[model samples]
Target: MTEIWQQSPDGRPLVIDPEGGYHAAFLPRTADAPRPLAAFEPFVTACLAALPEHQREPGARLGLELFLLGAARRFRHAEPLADEELLAGLADLFERHGIARGRLLDLLGELPALERAQATRQVLDEGAATVEEWLASHNQNLTVRVRERLPDWARDLEA
Candidate 1:
């Protein structure tokens, strides 16, 4: 099947070649799309659901990276996002990613959305920690932790 997310907003074709390696343009989505971070929720949910049974490290890591990068894109936009709207969206985004998704939904149920990304980068910056960094220096114990969290497919990656 065609990649659902690869279709651009205006319907232009978008190509993402996993083999080509790191292409900046291939980020989660444009930094300015409407509800971009929130858009990641479903994909995150898929990852969380698939991880325990899927055993594909690359898929797991890619899922997290794509979802977070999508969130990061939303955050990176220069335009102002309402704090309440953004926070709500972020909570929704996280809930979508969280395995115990209900708690996040409940916690965010009454809160105003957060827009901390534009107020400062500190919060959004936290999301910038990359899989590469996580994998590179993790102590053997941490490595095991990372391995457990990752889909089995990602284990053989060379970086």
Candidate 2:
């Protein structure tokens, strides 16, 4: 079924950037096709990369959902997101697109791992190590530990 999203159920719009301040038009639905959010994942993933940087803010969190709806509403548009950025991109996503905040957390199952990866990246960056070194060293030991704890498919290419 072809999808159509006027805006996220909550009502923020989609915005992104290499520099973080672009807005896409929100077109209303004129068709009856069910909006399959799952289909928008890849597009949301790509827009996640261009999302703006901001520290915690409760009022402005639906970024990911808005992007998902936008792209699902217009899928033929951009590139898919890379695996590494998906979760962090998503954390930011929740704020800007959430319909009921609770709705924002539909994928709560993914957060623990996402947090671990972000922490790993922070530790690696602080250590000033190369990506290769970060992978080789036990510097961000949490990421490794988390991978060890999860099922095989949960692991990344590094495994």
lDDT of 2 by residue, 1-159 (tens): 222233332343333335533333233333573333334343333334433332132211332333233233233223345422332333344444433323443424343464365432332232232222333552444334322322222222123
The C-alpha lDDT values of all candidates are: 0.39, 0.33
Model 2 regions lying over 4 Å from their true place: 1-40, 76-159
Q: Which stretches of candidate 1 lie over 4 Å from their true place?
A: 1-38, 42-50, 53-80, 96-159
Instruction: Give me the overall lDDT of model 2.
Output: 0.33
Please tell me which predicted candidate would have the highest TM-score against the true structure.
1
My TM-score estimates for the predictions, one after another, are 0.27, 0.22
